[model samples]
Target: MTAISRTGAGRRGVATLICGALAAGGLAAAGAAALAPGAAYASSHREAPLISGTPQYDNTDVYAFVSPDKPDSTTIIANWIPFEEPAGGPNFFQFAEDAQYDLHIDNNGDAKDDLIFRYTFNTHTKNKKTFLYNTGVVESLDDPDLNITQTYDLELIKLKNKRVEHETKLADDVPVAPSNVGKASMPYYSKLRDQAIYKLPNDAKTFAGQADDPFFLDLRVFDLLYGGDLSEVGNDTLKGYNVNSIALQVPTDLIAESKHQPIVGIWSTTQRRNAQGYYEQVSRLGNPLVNEVVNPIKDKDKFNASEPKDDAQFLKNVTNPELPKLIEAIYKIKAPAEPRNDLVDVFLKGVKGLNQPPYVTPSEELRLNTSIKPSMHPKRLGVLDGDNAGFPNGRRLTDDVIDASLQVVEGELVGSKNDLGDAVDKNDKSFEKYFPYVALPTEGSRGKTAKSSADTKSALGDGLTGATSENTPLIAASAGAGAAGILLIGGGLMWWRRMRRNY
Candidate 1:
């Protein structure tokens, strides 16, 4: 039987909650997990203070959905390094070589992960003598002119009760798509991205590269909640930004439980090597705004380091949320009553019958029922609009989580129907219809240079001249100034070497 048919009671149960408190005139709170791996915005991108300073290892968003073109397979995409400016180059963006990026899945109702896909990257530089991200117009992934490149290894791990039962290296030395350096460097950026998509065993596929920041929403909500008058609305704050992404697609049966039970919970985390060299989870994400909007400041850092099995310790934040109270005080809207089991049902435990697994353990993760097919024209509001294949059921790239979350958090399910939103809707760029559906990264030379091939080649040739071409003259002049000049040159060379290493 299909998931929708089997979970009829669960859907009805949710409806009952929606209808029961129609007269309350209270705010419905938005709380749930997951977003398209390509999507951006919300607190998931640098949501916590400590993680914010370390963008490379910070998880921005996570997306899991039944592949639209290949419904028999499931696709999971996770992004890191939020708000990547295409023009921000020289060193550009690359996955952290010292960190482990992981996608965790809970096939059973228990909070423990049953399967994990771990990705680790390694960076290689061809011409370190030249401080250029690329020595010339990089035509391909393996081009020597592409001064810096990255490759990753993908490992599939099966676990039982939080212990690894088996481990298999699914892929090794897979090339990562280079950053969109611009028309001069990567005029065929899409072609480069296509080359990065790797076909794996069991008809699976994987991709790691730079893509457009798919998350769309006004980030100005921090300014006194839209200037306390809803004036801050309709702006797509992350429009031109880019993000580093890792995407994978596998057969539905691969990650699903038995045919009798098909729901799976998904989340992603980044474990960075601390000073002691032991990997420690520094960032985590599942739901769109859980840590950003739900967890308080004191718990934000703690939430990143915690596991879902221990989420009960933070239950009070969800049961008695502070966002609604803040909205109530500012907008004169009535806040929902305390001890909100509705939130626990939606955010922690999967909705009964719909996506909930047998004997659920009430943990935070994006839940998806493999039995549910993809929607051709999915609604942005997701389940609220009866689109079962979208978010809260595995986030899609097009789901308008910000608006949907706004209404849900303001009491759409518990009677207080509202249309509250930040006014932003869809992404500034359209998404691709094929595998690794994220939009192409914004170009570094967007609307600036339209250089000809000769012009580009000439520029690269000029850039190839090492630091001696420019700085040697200065050092020579300083040497003529005697002892003071020697000290200055020593300090200058040390600073130059450090800068080169950083890039």
Candidate 2:
């Protein structure tokens, strides 16, 4: 919701790179550039037009890494849809039965996944009788002995040559239980989620489940862009929140060679009933939902529809899209001095190698090469300074990726010739050490006649009391102009392009 605007030219440049090839004539290229359009940052939680309506199968984000808790193993997590209220349920969220939930790994960087873990869910509703809520006071049952029960099953499918190489049923050895509905159901949701965890053929660990959501961002700030104050919106808004989560843990050895060269790229997808009974898909490939939406690209729909398993074909589409030329045509500025074959290298190969002078890494892809082991964890990895918990490693909740992305475009971390912007700290909040990491509170509990254990826990985690305030400015003064210009230009170009396409 942050209304950062890119100028017409800047947006045109972005649009050209993303839309499609430049026309044969120089004028045509210019015409395409002029048609560049605006692109918006699709919110990982509630951005997609289709998925937002269907939370059960909508995948909000996907994360993969070697477990910090157990460095020897890898963990893959996919969050289905977003904004799930823990207590909001006559029927709580569950995975789709017809959908395929998968975890992909690319040991060989052809931009394709070498290993895959697919899962499906089945729910059995019994007794045919239904009640919305259980008030602890049980009414007379027509059939006292008849009770409702539900359960599901999971599977791990390995693929080679686009065909199933092997299929392993996780439920074969483990019992798959349905989520806990209430007392009658025993709330065994956690246990059912745990059943999905299994050991791979090589003793590698794997898991999938619905855990609380772990992403934090301020949508209110975006709403304020039309005309509102973001300064008053503290980081507390995202505190004590939760979302549905799917997690997996595996061994790095199972994913990459000991040599540790970069060997993985990840993506998540959601398929729903299309106009035809066939499924329509929505995907987040390589670094969550950024590239397909925020970063420049022409085939936004195609990007969303494609799967990570088909990366070889799509990688080429991402690297050499006709959009760039279209942007150049619109902007009237010369493109990067040299032919950017490195676009493929940086966008597809990975960012580690792209950190050189003159050239800067294009979009941030969370790259995890099994080989590089830092002696210490970085404070902030992606965009948050001192935030080592972001992309190219593993993304964390507190990472202010918008700021990080601006920094990347400006080439701040790698020191490109391009003029970069200063950093911004929109939300000056700190986090708690719990399942969902979020900022602590700044006030003390009031109007409380008596404090219970739950109150005390909430107080401690709320950060309202005994919490220090940090006055970190979200954006440096110097960065405002260039960043705004880039946003406006880029956005304008995207808008133009879309209009042209429609015609």
lDDT of candidates 1 onward, in order: 0.76, 0.41
The ten-residue window of minimal lDDT in model 1 covers 19-28
Q: Give the clash count for model 2.
A: 70
lDDT of 1 by residue, 1-503 (tens): 12221121332232322322221212123432221111112346778889889999988888889999999999999999999989997889999999999999999978889999999999998776776787666777887668899999999999998889999999999999999988877777888999999999999999999999988876766666654544335568898999999999999899998788999998899999989989998888877776776677898888888887887777676666777787677666777676665455665666666787889887778889888899988877777677888777878989877666665556666776555555555899999999999999998885444354445545444435453344354445544678787889999999999999999
Candidate 2 per-residue lDDT over residues 349-450, each given as its tens digit = 354432111122222234564443422443332412432334434445444443344333322323332211112222344543322222222111122232
TM-score for candidate 1, please give it.
0.85
Best model per TM-score = 1
Q: Roughly what TM-score does model 2 have, to 2 decimal places?
A: 0.57
| Residue 464 in model 1: lDDT | 53
Q: Predict model 2's lDDT versus the native.
A: 0.41
The TM-scores, one per candidate, come to: 0.85, 0.57
